[model samples]
Target: MLNLPKEKVIFAGYATFFMISLTKTTNNRLKDKLKTKSYTTRGG
Candidate 1:
């Protein structure tokens, strides 16, 4: 077990969580844009 400081461990956890959520939101936005584009092209 590598000895990491407590604060560093907590900070790493929060950073990882933040990055995951950020990626999810970005993916959702991209998906929404693609859906809208397809819908418009289909004349919906």
Candidate 2:
């Protein structure tokens, strides 16, 4: 009995996708920064 409108549901789906992508990218950037810092500390 899920009676939801089409456009609203689609919009919400897209919003969720964008949020997930943003989080993944943000995490990746943080990981890259940590790796860079570790390498620099070890190398120097």
Quality of model 2 by C-alpha lDDT: 0.94
lDDT of 1: 0.94
lDDT of 2 by residue, 1-44 (tens): 35567778998999999999999999999999999999999999
Error of 2 at 44 (Å): 1.2
What is candidate 1's lDDT per residue for 1-44, written digit by digit as tens? 35668778999999999999999999999999999999999996
Q: What do the candidate models score in CA lDDT, each in turn?
A: 0.94, 0.94
TM-score of 2: 0.87
Q: Residue 9 CA error for candidate 1 (Å)?
A: 0.3
lDDT for 5 in candidate 2 is 77
Clash count (model 2, backbone only): 0
Question: Model 2 Cα displacement at 25 (Å)?
Answer: 0.4
Off by over 4 Å in 2: 1-4
TM-score on alpha carbons, each prediction: 0.87, 0.87
